[model samples]
Target: MAYSDIQKTEFNRVTENLIEITWTYVNLLEEFPRLDEQDSMSWKQMFVAWANEFEELYGHTNWIESEKTYPEAVEEFAKEKILQWAGIRKYICVGKHIEGITLNPYEWLLEKGQDVKLFESEAEAKIYLKTNGYTDEDMEFLKFEEVWH
Candidate 1:
């Protein structure tokens, strides 16, 4: 049987995240069918096997690890997840200068500061401030265009 829409979407999402975070390669269409036929498996089963195969083939290291002593590996994966999401979302941070210090908008918001926010789009930021108790006189919008090096 051919892969369903949901299966295809999920396979794509998982593989894309894996590729972005781990730089691993997995060709879904070619590999999925082969794996499924070889094992007589469903899409979900095939997907899990595919992921495990990637980890085995590409996620190996010489160092030994355990749950108690190697928490950093998990931490590193979480960090990479955050970075991958950030890269995909392309969020722009809105922060006010405070005490001559500038912080990331996300950090400022997390600290309960009212002057900073994060938004995926400039229009959303303007709309949020307009609706959330900020008057025209109380707020000034600053746009920082990103420059890629």
Candidate 2:
């Protein structure tokens, strides 16, 4: 399963927003010398300055700071969204016909209805199959397919 068009669009939007926010932070730090002075401002004041600078530059305000600070919220949100997107990915070893039969290792593993092993990489899958009596010739027929749900 792959991501839906809407999910992909949302992912792109969030990623772009994160990039813009990072650039905004960088630009603010470069433009305003006082923002970097930790001794001159408390955490709350620093956050207010950051939020004000972000609003001034982007013309948009964020209220995520009410629960957590702006920086913390941004970091947490980005991490959560990225992890959510990543969690939907699934991988399997798909076998193509080479020696007169399509021998799908993943299918064989799943047929028992037990815990089927999922590989993260083609190399890892290939190694596992080879170690488990699959010859190099058989390995040539293996393909790694990524399914995103």
Worst 10-residue lDDT window for candidate 1 reads 23-32
What RMSD, rounded to one decimal, does every model reach? Answer: 15.3, 19.0
**Per-residue lDDT value at 6 in model 2:** 44
For the record, the alpha-carbon RMSD of candidate 1 to the native fold, in angstroms, is: 15.3
Candidate 2's residue-wise lDDT over 1-149, tens digit each?
A: 55554444244433445464445445545544444454433533444444444445444435553665655555544333332333444466444544546553334343345655567667887777778899988666555665423
Which model scores highest in TM-score? Answer: 2
Give me the displacement of residue 82 in model 1, in angstroms: 17
Residue pairs in clash, model 2: 1-148
Q: Give the TM-scores of the predictions, in the order they appear.
A: 0.28, 0.33
* Model 2 / residue 102 / CA error / Å: 7.0
Off by over 4 Å in 2: 1-86, 97-111, 114-116
Q: Total clashing residue pairs per candidate?
A: 0, 1
